[model samples]
Target: MLILKQLILGLLLPAVVGGGIFIFAKSLAWKKESEQKKARLSGWLVAVALSAGYTVGYTGLEGLPPFPPREGVHWLCYLSIIGLISGAFWHSSRWGRLIVQIALSIVIPRLLLNSAFKYTWGQFEGIIWWMCLAVAVFIFWHIVQESFTILPAGGSSPFVYFGLSGGTALVLAVSGSLRLAQHAGILVAIFAASWVITFVRQRSDNNKWQVFPLGASPVVALLLLGIWMNGYFYEEVPAASAILLAIALFLAPVGRIEKIQRLGARRSAIVQICVIALPVVIAIGIAVARSGLFGESSSY
Candidate 1:
């Protein structure tokens, strides 16, 4: 019953609330349209809707946040608010967005890894680990947002993330922490909401993403990174699985070539999702085999 409730509330709440926000935003005449068309042109709206859904669904699942946030996972709530504000206002300037991205890179790794740095590792080790992670976050965020601009219209980005979240959830479930898995699962719901909305709304639009809702990129990226960081460092996820899962979303843009684009919107999205599925499927299979979910010994 508890599992069913989590699935029910976790799945439905984010989808319903986030879907409502998307619909509302879609209805508004934000401004003039160019000769070329785009779908969900307002990135901040995407960020707002997804972030709001995450915050609300998180509350529903875990109840209210305690003062000072006793758990590091709880920090996502506050960081998301920060991400939303930064994403919403900085949509117009490229350099403005880059600055925000760099600042977050510096903060989030240490933010989630303070105790690990101070108590678990030596100074040199901590600095080395922090530098690599910060750099990776910066690069990943840059690629995803850039993809939003370059990739042909088809809502492929949301589809990629939806698949990524589902893969992460399954991997986390088999990694000895259902708690962490549920966190990833919340993201699954949020992206699923976006996936449906984007796929529907972009049926005719095929312009380059000008004034696109690129804001959702960082929010989605941060959630995935934070989940993996917490799961591996603080929970039971293996280092190998963590590495594999972290790079999974990087394959998202591989299917954006001219050939795939000519396949049309729906088919193009399918190709992109399939490309992303390579890493996700491998990670899930490895995680399941490692944990012996089917009652057999296996290797990671």
Candidate 2:
């Protein structure tokens, strides 16, 4: 019953909010290319807003009030606001988009690392290790951003990615923190709902598919944060496996896969599914092995 409630709230509530934003954007005149661009930006802004509100509300419900030490939630809220504001300027200038990307790169890694160190590890050590992790996260974000940018506009690939994130959340829920998993589920629901409506409206208008930082940034950030928190703090998942899973998730954008790249969207999506599944299978196998060992040791 509790799971059902979380699923509905996590999925349904954000869907409504996202759907509303899509409707409003579609209702606009958008006669000029500039107007259409702004409309699309506005939709992303709404996505960020939904993400922030849902994060705050979800965490609060879990008895973690919006306060210090719960810095992860606060950082998410801050990122969403900054993303929405910065994203508004994205369509106006190249410098604006670059600024937003840089801001996210700086803030998100710091936030996730801080949360992991403070809440899970209890102290920040190994400066070189920390730097390496931060660098990896930044690179991963860049790859995801590039992936979204290159995907055929109006293509449903992004939605598929979002759905995969939700699946990741469910896996975490079973193996790690339920609260974090619920938050991830909510993020997926919001984005998925918004994407469907936006795809349909844009199809009707014949608008090219474009990527918005506001929507993609938080989703990726939240997913990485969840993985780190679950692996380090909860210790339900093995840290090495979690790190490998994170690395694998970002590998989908590697352009070296010539055979997969040549295929059409439908075939390409199938290839992506196969690529994503490989790491997930490995991670799950590691997790299961660890759990079995722990169980045997405990029985002793």
Instruction: Identify the leading candidate in terms of lDDT.
Output: 1
Model 2 alpha-carbon drift over 4 Å, by segment: 1-5, 26-32, 39-43, 49-53, 56-60, 63-65, 69-74, 91-126, 198-208, 211-219, 226-234, 254-258, 292-300
Model 2 residue pairs with clashes: 153-209, 154-209
The backbone clash count of each candidate, in order, is: 2, 2
Alpha carbon deviation, residue 88, candidate 2 (Å): 3.2
Residue 17 deviation, candidate 2, in Å? 1.3
Q: For candidate 2, what is the TM-score? A: 0.72
Per-candidate TM-scores read: 0.86, 0.72
| Residue 267 displacement (Å), model 1 | 5.3
Where does model 1 exceed 4 Å of error?
Answer: 29-41, 201-212, 256-269, 295-300
| Model 1 lowest lDDT segment of ten | 32-41
lDDT of 1: 0.74
Alpha-carbon deviation at 51 in model 1, angstroms: 0.4
| TM value for model 1 | 0.86
